[model samples]
Structure formats: C-alpha cells, structure tokens
Target: MSKAIMDLTELLERVENDRELIRDLLLIFKEEFPRHLQALRDAVDSMDGEKVAAEAHTMKGMLSTLSATSAASAAARLEQLGRNRKVCEFQEAYAAFENISKKLLLQLDTCMAEVGG
Candidate 1:
C-alpha cells in the first residue's frame, strides 16, 4: 500500500485518543482549507510577500497539528520564500504546496470516514 499522508497515531495521541475530536478537527479543516488555499493563491498572485508568509505560516501550523509532515514542510518552504521576498519562486513553491495539500485533503477525508465523522 501507499504510505499514509498524515501520522494518525501521533495525531490521535495528541488528541488524547478521542476519535470524535479528530473527526471534528478534520471536518473543520475540510471546511477551512479552501479559504486558506485561496488566500495563499491571492497573496502569491499579487506578489504580497507578507500576506503569503502569514498564510503559509497559518497553513503550516494547521498541517503540523494534523501530523502531515510533508504538507507542513511544503508550507514551511513557501513561508520561507515569502519571508525572503522571493516573488519569483512563489508560483513554484505554491504549486508544490498545493499538490501536497490536495493529497492531505484526501487523507483527511479518509480519516474522517474511518472515524465515522
């Protein structure tokens, strides 16, 4: 089988093994992810370094909470690019982050399903 996107074991531990809490968090993430993604896209398109940095930072925190290491790493890269004011690299970095985030969404859906949320 393919590798899991997020570390559910770690995440569950962090949440005190409350599957309901995990499901709730996943639902919230699913609801909010698109808005966050759009904000990041807008920031990137407008070449707003500060906004990009802020958005990426928020996304990194969210992904980290879910134990999505790869997606969090991608967000961190984008955050750094924004911090360094690397507008030229924004598109590439955002694309990579977006790709990982899409997979993360899928994983979250699967997790929610498994938890009966």
Candidate 2:
C-alpha cells in the first residue's frame, strides 16, 4: 500500500497522544480544505501572484500541521513561485499539489469515517 498523506504520528505526539483531538483537528482540516483549494485555484487562474502566494502559504501551514510533508513542500514551492511573481510558472507545482491534496482528502475522509463514525 502507498503511504498516507496525512500522517498523524507526529501530530498525535504533539497533542500528547490525544486521539480525539487529532480526530477533531482532522475534521476541521477536512471541512475547510476545499475552500482553501478553490481559493488557490482561483488565484492561479487569475494570475494573481499575491493571492497565489497568500493562498499557498495558508495551504502550507495547514498541511504542515497535519504532517503532510509532500503536499506541504509542493505548497511551499507554489508560494515561492508566487513570491517571485511567477504565477504562470507554477503549473507543474500546482498540479502536483492538487493531486497530492486530493489524495490527502480521500485519506482524511477514510480516517474520519473510521474515527468519527
């Protein structure tokens, strides 16, 4: 099997092994991720470099919190591209980030089902 996107091991440790808290945080991430993704996409589509940087930074923070390293790195790259005013240069990074994020969302859904159900 492939590695999971949202690895809770580090997060679980940081939270003192509170599984419930982990579940709650993951739920929050699940609820808000789509909106963030949409905003990022819109920013990219509009070639708004500032918006792209801001959205990508926000995404980086969120993914980092969940220990989603690959996605977070992708987000960081997107942010850097935006910072360089290279919005048009972020197609590859954005695509990779989007793909990873979708996979993470699916993993989160499965986790939430397992924990919240």
Candidate 3:
C-alpha cells in the first residue's frame, strides 16, 4: 500500500471503537467519494486549478473524517499545489489520491463483507 492509504491502520482502530461509526463512514464514502472523484476528474479535464483546489479540499475533509491518512494527505497536497498554482504538482497529487482511493475502496469492501454488510 502507498503512504496515502497507510493511515487505514489507525482507522481500523476507530472501527473497533464503534461499529456504527464505521457504518456511517461507509455511507459517507459511498455518497461523497464518488462526487469527490467527479469533481477531481472535471478539474483535471479542464486543468482548472481553482476547481482542483476546491475538490481536493473537499476530499481532504472527507478522507480525514474517515481517517484515511494517506489519501487525505495526498488530497491536502493537491489542494496546496492548486493554491500555489503548481499544476504539475497538483496533477501528481491527484494521481496519488486516485490510487489510494481505489485501494481504500477495495479494503472497505472486504471489511463490509466481513461484517456481512
């Protein structure tokens, strides 16, 4: 796993503290993550740093709530890059977040399955 998804280990600890919280997080992931991705895709397609930063900030907040450290950090970096007009860095950060997001989703699937969700 990349550094972006590494915080999932800590998130797992949270899940143990409250199954309902995990369920709530899963719902947010199902709902917000897709929208976050679309915003990112549109930002990338348009090469709009403003939109990129907005989307990255949104993703960062959501990922932080889920305790997805690596993804959140990646998103934060993208947001920062966008804010700084560093398009190349933003693009790289977006790619990193994309990878981490996929891995997180897959891991979530397994977690949900284990709980018969």
Q: Each model's TM-score? A: 0.94, 0.91, 0.81
Better of 1 and 2 by TM-score: 1
lDDT of each: 0.91, 0.86, 0.76
- Rank by TM-score, highest first: 1, 2, 3
Cα displacement (angstroms), candidate 2, residue 65, comes to 0.6
Which candidate leads the pack in TM-score?
1
* Per-prediction backbone clash count: 0, 0, 1
What is the model-wide C-alpha lDDT for candidate 3? 0.76
The window of 10 residues in a row where model 1 has the poorest summed lDDT is 106-115
Clashing pairs in 1: none
lDDT tens digits by residue: candidate 1, 32-110: 9999999999999999999999999999998999889999999999999999999999999999999888877777777
Mind giving the per-residue lDDT tens digits that candidate 3 earns over 1-117?
A: 333443545666866756567766777687778877988978966778888889899988988877877778888988888778787676667778898888888777665554446
Higher-ranked by TM-score: 2 or 3: 2
User: What lDDT tens digits, residue by residue, belong to model 2 across residues 34-112?
Assistant: 8999999998988888888999999999899888898999999999998898866877778989999988987887776
| lDDT for residue 108 in candidate 3, whole number 0-100 | 72
